[model samples]
Target: MAKPERHPRKTIPAASGPTNSAEEAKDGKDAGYNAGMAVFSYIIGGIIVWSLIGWGLDYLWGTRWIVLLGALLGAAGGFYLSHMHGLTRQGSSSGGSAADRGPSQDGAQ
Candidate 1:
């Protein structure tokens, strides 16, 4: 019987540490979740504070629209400020060291 030819196999580099791609992805997800939660908290807090102020003003001025408008503005501003802060912090942290090392698929580089 004739022997069959075997194809060569490809080899991949082994991981050196306990961490892997899945763990990194999970960590990223957790960080995003935390950031989102922080923003939500800020908006909710602003809504409560603004609602009180709006109610007090409406009571004195006898205008209902002012309260609604104030609450809306407060919520928008709070969300914007929170989001900006998050971006600033993320930018600062992501701009240094590891992120600048190479071309990363996740855009961290």
Candidate 2:
């Protein structure tokens, strides 16, 4: 005895366009999500590290205000780092090169 063969009920056609807007939009969303995550991580990391240092200093100095100062400094440092790393701003000077932006009108290279 032989068993019957199975077949797919439906088939999907391939896309024929030069560009895929859906894919591009997905990529843009992913990039934005990644940037947001990076910013969050930077801020959190700074806070943790600075807070730890402040805690240690406070313990050694027998004081309770150093931890607060450390937390504030960490926050400021994190924001500065994020801005420097281009995670805080969009389309800023840290973006792509001149060629990516477009041709240079100025004669200098």
Candidate 3:
């Protein structure tokens, strides 16, 4: 019969070399999750606030279309603001070197 192995295999990192890459991966995912949450919150918050304001205005003026108008404007404003402050900012920060930008489209060849 074959002899059993002696020492058990260790899971590494026990000697203080390089930590597992899983930690870094988890951190990146957490950051992305947080960013997503923030974006969602911004969109939801903007729309709700504006919609409420519009509803109040309609109640005061006894109008109906204003609410619809307000909701639409609120959605547009929310999306615009979210993209501007969240996606655009993050993209710019992580957008590698300036050379990554495509060549300018100026007419001067």
Candidate 4:
């Protein structure tokens, strides 16, 4: 005699309303934004510090261009460093591009 085939059973959770999920998703987005902003602020602060150092150097050497160059270099370095740090924290890339893992609530993929 042939044996009967058994079927796999699936289970679904009982939940109502979309509010809970929406709120949770929004919180996640907010957290990411806040983290990114914090990193950006730190970068700006670093740039300011560099500018101050450049100013001091200028004053000591009696040369304005040298100080200006230092300030510019510092700003560039700060921006690069901050961008990398921010991306790393967010678990993303510095390319500013996002890949869709699947459909989101907003129909974004």
Q: Which candidate is the best by TM-score?
A: 2
What residue pairs are clashing in model 1? none
- Screening candidate 3 with a backbone cut-off below 3 angstroms (N, C-alpha, C), the clashing residue pairs are none
lDDT of 4 at 95: 39
- Candidates' lDDT values, in order? 0.78, 0.86, 0.76, 0.71
lDDT of 1 by residue, 1-109 (tens): 9999999999999878637799887887888788878888888888888888888899999988877877897798788889678632554445576646567678663
> Ten residues in a row with the worst lDDT in model 1?
86-95
After superposition, which runs of candidate 4 have C-alpha atoms over 4 Å from their true positions?
A: 1-19, 86-109
Candidate 2 ranges beyond 4 A from true positions? 1-19, 91-109
Native-referenced Cα lDDT, model 2 = 0.86
User: 19-96, model 4: which lDDT tens digit per residue?
Assistant: 678888788789888877766676677667788888898899887876667667776786777677654343554333
Cα deviation of 29 in candidate 2 (Å)?
0.6
- Per-prediction TM-score, please? 0.54, 0.64, 0.60, 0.53
What order do candidates take by TM-score, descending? 2, 3, 1, 4
TM-score of 3: 0.60
- Give the per-residue lDDT of model 3 (tens digit) for 29-76: 887888788777777777788888899999999998777777778778
Which ranges in model 3 have alpha carbons more than 4 Å from their true place? 1-19, 88-109
Error of 1 at 83 (Å): 2.7
Number of the top lDDT candidate? 2
